[model samples]
Target chain A: MGKGHPTAARAFVDNRERAHWHDTALWFVREKRDRQAGSLPEWELLRETASSIKRHAQSQLADYLLQFEHEATANGAVVHWANTTSELNEIVTELLQSVDATDVVKSKSMLTEECHLNEHLAEEGIDVVDTDLGERIVQMRNERPSHIVLPAIHTKKEEVGELFHEQLGTEKGATDPQYLTEAARQHLREKFLNADAAITGVNFAIAETGGIVVCTNEGNADIGVSLPKMHIACMGLEKLIPKLSDLSVFTRLLARSATGQSITTYTSHFHKPRRGGELHIVILNNGRTELRAEPEIRDALHCIRCGACMNTCPVYRRSGGHSYNTTVPGPIGSVLNPSMDPKEHNSLPFACSLCGSCSDVCPVQIPLHHQLLTIRHSVKEAGGLAGSKRLSMRLASMVFKRPWLYKLTAGLGKCAVRLTPRFIKYSRLNVWGKGRELPPTPRGSFRKWYDKNGGSGGR
Target chain B: MTRMEVAVVGRTTSRDLILNKIRAVELPDVSHPLVDGVLTGAIEYADTVGTFVGSAESVGARVHFCDTDSVVDIWHDICEEFGSGKTANVGIRGLNDDDLTDDSPHSASELVVYGTSGILGVAENAAIWVSDRAINHRVSLCLTQHLVLQIDAKSIVNNMHDAYAKLQDVRDDYGVFISGPSKTADIEQSLVIGAHGARTLDIIVVEG
Candidate 1:
């Protein structure tokens, strides 16, 4: 099982030792929040406006898709549609085969990961190298990214040094970030210069201009896509925007929220292919349309793929990225993964603490917690609820329906809090205690204290 | 001749043929008139490129605001970040006449800071586009442990047209538009920001 594989929960448990790295990562993001927000005193207004723009765009996604196909085709960029992962894989493999590409360099495209493109490509005897530093690390380890922005954050510099030593042959014990970074640059540069074709993930596809925007901190995306004669851009259909003008607000919010930078190092804009460069835009449905059809959850399509909401989320910080067990994990992923295949991804919705920090930090202002609750409700409605969970929830609901019973149950809960041992005997109960401490119960309940202190009416 | 690259799937039915027989489909009405002069105004002032600052009051950051081909002043401002470290550069607008020497420290104040001409934003994606020109060492934007960018208020535009129209004629080179930080939630569906890029961003907006 892979590091993030479902069967690899034991490995995940071991990696929880690095929870401090996770905490530091999130704290760093939290610190950047005010600077990013301060850049636009109209930050909230801009978020509302962006949400509306994404909503309006999603409402007309079908039209935009058709328009994009028309414009892209007219501009000499081929457009292909894939309703499933297999279809997407086939299309890409065929394109590669058609071009006789042996070694393909790819910039950071989460779509390729979603479709498992590399494994399929590898099976076909095509070697694909991820040019992003974090992607490269995960590629070397054959592990899925632990975090979207910092895929290799779970990896210490020492570990990276070891990986590079084994893979790239840097002397025995060089763990310097700068030295390691230079080694990566030197190594990836060779791949960038010689690759037959480059594949990139599109950050935004401006439908009005029929252009694809690729953002990266390293210049890898530009080198990969521009140098190659055949360039392919893989994007979720949800990546489309109605006009080019809309990129401004997102540019302002995306970097600030994702990494607290004014901007990513490189934002390459490609409209059709350049001279002697062939461009292709692949629009993969792969469950996006299904998500789009659902009114309550359709706004998920508006995600600019900035990882801000995830960074601010407490549960995500503690559990780390591998625990989510999906191509895209975290708050947005919890709501998004289900839409891809609800039955298999049902566990994702339960992965939240419902603190609503995600909604607060979301650049697009997605009501992430509400969407999560909706998914949880839907999962329960689908009869997928576990027996113990259902029983507990049912008992809890029953007490709430009757005041006397509620007070009696609340008293029982308070007593249990005091009586339950630090080491819970139940294996299932102990799972909840793994990441967090159980709150201590006072001699009396908060309600009782509030009542004695005088209620809101007294104030 | 090479075989046609089109894929052959199921046979086309008469119904499909009839559907395809339609010569043209009705197109949606797109009546908004393109404003010629409206785009030009921003393009003219677009030359009003500026550098970024930290906390708006830093001395070097201030000199970056009023840059005018004086290499000595630029070098001095850059040196202030380090307090008392030698710096090596091809040239600075305000500080040095001599070429950069080996005595220069790699950084000032623990980190070296540089300015970009301006920042670009993709309104559609909520991303801020900064060019390599603003960054030091080209990879400084992401490579440095800390990076600070100063952005002007008016450079902001609405969408891709604004981005293209402003820099459409820019010299062929590298540019980037960052949206927040580099991030991913690829783990157990837990969203964590600051995955691979800078962990923090400090933006100074100089108000006129």
Candidate 2:
């Protein structure tokens, strides 16, 4: 079983200051996304277009993948298929070993993280370096990325300064972000120059011309791909688009919804292999086909992994990304994780407040809250629902079914609450009363007071 | 090769297994985005160059707008200000593209600057479209310490919709929409320039 959400969240919220800092940082990004969305006259139209395009592509996934494979092969790319994440890791490791590549540099590819590719490669005795600054920081600390885009969002500069001192040998207490970033630049450039191979994640794979797009603000993907003789691109099956022209719609919305930039600094398109080099594209299914069969949550597959939902989600911001304990964390992760293992990740669906902010902020318009609620029902069907929640829900349904019983119980409950000792009412069993309190006892029940006050519309 | 040994199995069994699994699942056929009557909202701007400059500067790139007569002088001043290091001037009017093909320029030069034309500018986002046709060596665009690019003032478009409509002219084996120099906000959301590519990018918008 996975570490439960409530258990993990308690650890993060124990330090009130850090929790508030994390909340404020994510909120800042959310506000920036709002400004970008509001500036465009056709923002809603763009979202609808992108969503439909993804839906169409997904329904015809088999044909599109075939078309993309044919086109990419014609463009001189070697395409590999993997039914499982470990299969993907095997393919990547075999490719690396064939090239005699020991020192590998990889850009931020969450697919690899999901499959534990780094660990697998290390066991094979190949050294891999994460070129993205945020990813490098988290890798140095031996931790998973908390946020997809902002991998180091959970870390503070002062903490980074301490990390750099230990890892990159920076001056002690050098908390200046500029100085620290420069030191990282010097450190990573050496790795880039010496890397024997590079790996990247595909943001969009076009089927028309057989091209793959990788977007980054730091240009690490381009540098890594350009310098190495053997390069590998890892992609989920959901990354394909039918044609080249579809890029304009997705590219316009991706950055504005992400970090609120009009566009990323570098949106590089790699159609062919480098001069006298090799290009390998690994397409992974890894239980996504099962998710496609799920009618209520299949819309989650349209996600572009922009992390906007994570930025806007109140529960995600306060509880932190580590609380989810998944490769991709936050609103989308909560929806996708339970599909992987219902019994192990059943806590994820219950970790939401049913707030629709994530859906509203989602550029692809995934019905996240509705999906979470639907998944709650599915979890109950699978017998993975928590015991207390099932019990309370059962009692609530029984009480709500009969009006006479509810009224009689409410009158008696008011009397009992007023007469009981304070210790019993606020006992540990009352989880609702932990941070909140019951309202003061009324003089009489609402039904009795309303029935006697007046029968007319106005009193 | 060992890669081909593993490739044979990966291409056949795994491919058919995945495609078969996906095909068995029935899903509703949805309309393509373009066919669904959703327009791109053609945003027209009166002053494309002005809009391009503002957008580029907002993203931390410096844009120098000039005419054909005095454009080279601006590049000279820019090169002088940045440094007198190993600059790779590619297809510039007053400079030569000789340094661009230096043997291992990335390791040899302290600074490799590429002053190339064939850049298609977008007004909405300051995205300058470039491809292999512009410069023979695409890696220099990233390995350079300082980058100098040229774009025709008349070639600037209003938005990405218009830009993509006209991308056929420069689309090649590789293409990029470079708005600014490489930057990162990974460490505590702090904006740092020159993450792994060119530290400074100056786009010279030339008008006839």
Candidate 3:
């Protein structure tokens, strides 16, 4: 009823050619994931184990966080806890200022995006350069990332060529991917060398070892942090697992599920700060604590941010990532966003077609579609449904309770629909019929036909 | 806000509040996952070195096989490939016996970085394990334009499970499992060989 998701999705699908390209592109990734998962005979067992580990970790999140903090501190790294996004941003800003860092280089971090850290840093006159090629492309173009793994999936090579030509002075109209990527390589090389600080998102924070693992294909995170004198890692509190051995389970599933790679090119373990440098880890609890309180939907926290759900989702593939209007998108985003703020994001849960592909591909088996269904029920119970929708539901429930009334209304409704004009049938009041046609009335109701055919107790 | 107010707001109250919230949540006790033997019968290669070379090459890395007696000739060939314009900077930690280092300044932006392998290589993903202690400088592996890793031919493992088992015994500050040269398909799903790290990865396997 809010119409936010549908309106945005309509805008995305209006460009039929681009919409088709987007759907095919994502489905291709999904197919690749299927192939990668099929290569491993223990893929299902791995998923079960990963899900069980996450369940254990989430149940004891407080203890794990405390242990991680203690070990991280003992390793001479600074640890900070932020309860809100603004607090997270302020903590990062203060850390950057403490190091007197005016130029900061960052790898792909969804946490920073959620905290709006770039905008916050810009207000304070600190320059932050996104070092990931996809992130940098979107940064230069002044756009949000459309996908988590492939941020620039929505932008074609021609668009990227133009953007780099304008920003990095590449040869005009050079739409070749290698050329565009090389040009960006040259451009980001300078930023990485001169950056005073580097920030990255933590993939998995090992509690037993008191370290973090940052995975990337381009090695941007490794290069970004290695060059700078200060490294700041920001992560949601849900990223913690119990031990270093747990990575064997997750590392196997992450890249295979995301991009169909056996593993990312570089899975660098950051255990300690480099000599003459500092490592600051910020653990953010922005809305995750509240999510943890909800028993029915708390399994959503097991997500490893693999983006497989988005790749496999039919609605997400067709609608595009921008339709969700959240930091993370697709089936996971629908459940997470509404839980964070139901009033604004209540429409997200209804965006799905309930196909259940998301749950099938989830590496940790998050039961994403089930969570979406639960969120919808909660939203409706909280009176988030529109007035007309609520009234219509009440009317349908009343008619459904009485068999005689239902049959009479069904017979009359068929006549009414047949008598109605085409324009009136497809009018604004009929939300479901906007992009669809109404079925022609049957000769009679099935009950009447069954009674005539002498079916058992049909009358 | 004043500086005092900012400092006070940044204190430990938020940590306490978050911990309190987490502690209050009542959840069913779930045991840790049993990870032993989930993956059994690792994939074995009849010819380990051949499979390693093929898999490495498939991932855009050049592979050379030689014995200890031919190590110098292989090093010379690597040098000749780079030509006289670029002198390779051999890391002092692992490649001291190879005699590949010249009087170069060990610049951070060196075109070629030669180092010896630290641990076993995984045949399944063609990934070689390197740790901080094994390499002279950790940044050299990432900053160099070309990375040359000298590995022993017999240390190749069958899969990742064996690779992790080997790594768990070593105590080091940092370690990485690099499968190939830095690559990205971020732009329109186009595979580009080099992005931020080494553009060329050459693995030379010497007889153990």
Candidate 4:
């Protein structure tokens, strides 16, 4: 079993310097998002319209998928469907094998990460190199990407330089990002030119135009897909939109909310195969339909994987994405992971401070905090709550239910806490006291202080 | 078979099961909103061409504002600075598919400059539209060392909404909106100008 969020976060925040900068860096991105979102006077309307569009799409998803498949097939492209992650992986492997592809290049794809596609492909003896710089760094280190958008957000530049020195043979201690990126560019360029196939993630799949849009800032997807003879695009089944014109709304909000840019560097649309090349899109369900059945939290499906929620999440910014221990970490992950496995990720919903910043910045206007709250109840009802948390809640309920018990404990609990030794008070049993010190016992209960000042109790 | 028996034995292909699950999902049936090209807070560009140049320059593209007559001179000067080597021209007359080997998008030349190549210019974001229909070799837009786009000033639109509106009739099998030269801030959030695509994007906005 994996450690809970608090335990992992303790290790993350242990390095005070890194934690501080991590917080500052994410906050900087959050501020940038604000500036971009603020630039649009119709931002709220856009969010509402996007939310409406997503809901409409969710309602008629099956029809849109059928429409998309029909149009795509007519456009001379092949469409594959997968009900599970393993099935998706097998389909991609078979496609690559059909072409006798030995070397493959892929751009940033959270779905592939969720399915561990690279690991699966590697077992098949097919080498798939991640082309995104951050993704490549984490790939080299044999680690899961902490954040969906910024895969190497947790790694320092010096560490990247060291990795490059060992792998690509750069200057021993050079820490400049510019110098390091240039090296990766030169290296990945060779990989792109030599790669037999290219795989990318679909940003938005238009049903009307039979096109799948792949947005990128580095232009990696375009170069790789264009150079290779075979291009396979993988996407979650929820990425479909009703019309081609619906793209403008998302494209407007996506880049602004993601990296504060007006738009990505490349928004390449693939409607058909390149000349004689093969275009195959693998649409993976992977429990998306199950997630859709959850009416209370169904709004969570509107996520475009922008990472804006992560950038604005106080807990995520401080504790880091690694603490979430999920493929797509932060607010959306907390809500989505519990739906997949309640027992494993029950602690995730409680990780948030309930600041509602995620909901505020969400381009699609998903009520994230509300969904997290609902998921928390669902987790407890599913018998996924930790015994320690259950015990604390039971004790609190016991005291609050009875006036005598509440008054008695209120008076004695402070003295007990004050008199107790630090070690005893902060024992392993006190899960609440793990990373934080209980605030100095409030001078006195507010009830007692109010009575002393001017109270009916005196009468 | 009875309905219950049929339902019990209905677990078939994954696609069927997946689509059935989606069909069972109960969500509020919302409608797609009608979108017009004119949107709120749309930037009013006093001069669309001038704004295009500024937006393009800000995003790391070298911009040249010239008339159709000066286009030749501008192309010549930029080409001289950008290696003065083999180039794959798309729409303009210089060197095209006839001159180069139409074999692969990855030309053997170290310096491949593509010119007279853009379909339109988007002023709001500086994204120029180009497609497989015109470019023939789409990879050269990114894989090449440099990209030189020659866009008519009248074709520049104010924002993405307008850009898409103009593209209603111009849909190709594969098209791209090249906003700027390749860039990435993925490595520790430090912005790098060139990643996998062209290092430089020079635009020749041919106006009156």
The best candidate in terms of TM-score: 2
Model 2, which residues run further than 4 Å from truth? A412-422, A437-459, B1-7, B35-38, B102-109, B168-170
Best first by TM-score, ranked: 2, 4, 3, 1
User: What TM-score, computed on C-alpha atoms, does each candidate reach?
Assistant: 0.74, 0.95, 0.92, 0.93
The candidate 3 chain B region of ten consecutive residues with least summed lDDT is: B97-106
In model 4, the clashing pairs are none
Off by over 4 Å in 1: A1-17, A416-438, A446-459, B1-208
Candidate 3 lDDT by residue in tens digits, A340-442: 8898888899888999999999999999999999998998999897676788889999999999899889988999999999989888888888667888788
- Overlapping backbone residue pairs in candidate 1 total 80
Every candidate's chain B TM-score: 0.45, 0.86, 0.80, 0.83
Error of 2 at B138 (Å): 1.7
lDDT of each: 0.64, 0.86, 0.84, 0.85
Taking the tens digit of each residue's C-alpha lDDT, what string does model 1 give over A348-385? 78877799988988989899999999999998999877
* Candidate 2 chain B worst ten-residue window by lDDT: B102-111
Please give, for residues A269-349, the per-residue lDDT of candidate 4 as tens digits. Answer: 999877669999989988888889888778888899999999999899989998988998999999999888777788899
Choose the strongest candidate by lDDT: 2
lDDT of 2: 0.86
Candidate 4 chain B: worst-modelled 10 consecutive residues by lDDT: B3-12
Which residue pairs come into collision in candidate 3? none
Off by over 4 Å in 3: A1-3, A399-420, A438-459, B1-9, B35-54, B85-94, B97-106
Chain A TM-score compared with the true chain A, each model in order: 0.93, 0.96, 0.94, 0.95
